[model samples]
Target: MTKVAVISANGRVGSLVVKELVERGYDVTGFGRKAQNTTVAQTYIQKDLFELTKADLAEFEVVVDAFGTFAPETLHLHVEVIKHLTALLAGTKTRLLIVGGAGSLYDDPEHKTQLVDTPDFPAEFYALAKAQTDALTELRKHDDVDWTFISPAADFQVDGKRTGKYILAGEELTLNDRGESIISYADYALAMADEIQNGDHIKERISVVGK
Candidate 1:
């Protein structure tokens, strides 16, 4: 069985990812700052993500960085966490899979503008979006660590239904049949689990959208 660890496993997306991995029969462990009444992980560790040492994660084959923050002041945590994880896994066999944002994806086919640069991008999420974008940029600089960044669609629906279907794309934002970029958290978790099993897009950034 493949061993997988999910950071921030108590969060919305992280929890779903943990559940999906568990359902798929992976030897999964979840890391969080506190214990939770409900969790799908076979093993749960209570520790601050930054406090984790390389030895602590040495046994896992893959690590999913599902950490997220919306607070204006803490938005920078996105990049910090990415840097920390990449640094920890550098020169190691463990693969780092990051939960990224769509803002960094190109808005046009010519690759001229990113979604974050478009006029219609949400102003409220600009900080978080930019931080995630910067996190991707930071991840790209680490060549020693094997990493894959997966960005959800523009409309990351918190309550959207799980269709168990999604489309994967490169750096450009992908739209469904209705000409919109959107994905439910459940479907995104499905895609994440599939990617973990496939390991096809190593050292690359991929996007997912609802079908």
Candidate 2:
């Protein structure tokens, strides 16, 4: 069985990822800031992510960081948490997958990625999202962990059931005729899990959406 460890078990996306993995028969372990909904997991470690030490990361093959939300105020903590987690997972074969945002991707041929250089986006959110993208860049210094930064569709959020369908894109962006990119939350979880099992887009940044 693939020994998988997921941080942020309490978060909406994290819980769904863990639940899906468990149902798929992987050895699922969850590290969460809360105490609820973890009984379904193989093992639960109740600890805040920043409080997690290098010793705590031992023996897990896959570590997915799904810890933050779209809320603007939590951006610094999100970036710092990823920095610390990558540092802790350094010097090992353990894989690191940081949950990224669509703000860093190209939404139109004539425009830059939505969040990086856009003036209309919220200032605090823009700064922090930019920082998160930068954190992924700085992580290349660690070379030990196999890292992947996954940016979801602007509206491809979690909070629903699995749809088992999504489209994987190779840049150029995927959008509907109406000029929008969207994927259900469950499909996003499926993509994250599928990447773990398939290893299709390792050491790269990719985006996903539903058909």
Candidate 3:
């Protein structure tokens, strides 16, 4: 069985991801924002990430940083947390899977990545998402054991078939005829857990879209 840790595993999307991982028989740990009623994971931590020690990263084989949503305040926290995590997991042979913002997906064929090129995506949020995207991109250059930064679709709408069926591709956005990119949270979690079970698409920053 694969042993995995999901940081920020108690939120809406994170919680679902944790459940899916646990159901897959992975030794899963769910990091919660604060101590709460718990039973979803093999082990549960109440403290936020600021309290995470290298010892925490040492506990699992793969760590998925999923502790955030689309909050602008989280951009700095995302970079700060990832830098801290990369350092903590360094030289340990432990894998890292980063979940990133979709703003980086471009809607227009002629534009810069939709998030980076758009003048008006979300004024308060774009910069931070862009920063996180850059952080994930830079991580790929490291000669590490295993690292993946998986970006979701431009339309990562919460409601959709949870079927794990989806498309995985490189730097370009996978768009349908309607011109919207979409992937369910279920599929996202499935892909993450599948990677933990048996690694694939390694050391790459890619995007996922449902058919």
Best by lDDT: 1
TM-score (C-alpha, index-matched) for candidate 3: 0.85
lDDT of 2 by residue, 126-152 (tens): 666686666666765666778887777
- Tell me each candidate's RMSD, in Å, in order: 0.9, 2.7, 2.8
- Residue-wise C-alpha lDDT for candidate 1, range 49-85, written one tens digit per residue: 9999999999999999999989898988988998789
- TM-scores, all models, native as reference: 0.98, 0.85, 0.85
Q: Which stretches of candidate 2 lie over 4 Å from their true place?
A: 69-73, 107-115, 119-128, 176-178
The CA lDDT of each predicted structure is 0.93, 0.76, 0.74
Number of residue pairs clashing in candidate 3, backbone atoms closer than 3 angstroms, sequence gap of 3 or more or interchain = 1
Worst 10 residues of 2 by lDDT: 110-119
> For this target, which candidate reaches the highest TM-score against the unseen true structure?
1
TM-score of 1: 0.98
lDDT, candidate 3, 1-211, per-residue tens: 6778888887666777788888878888877776872537888877677788888778688888886755665566766777777777777778988887776666667645566566767666667667776676557556654787788877666766788677776666677556667888878777766666767767777787776
Off by over 4 Å in 1: none
Model 3 poorest ten-residue lDDT run: 136-145
Ranking by lDDT: 1, 2, 3
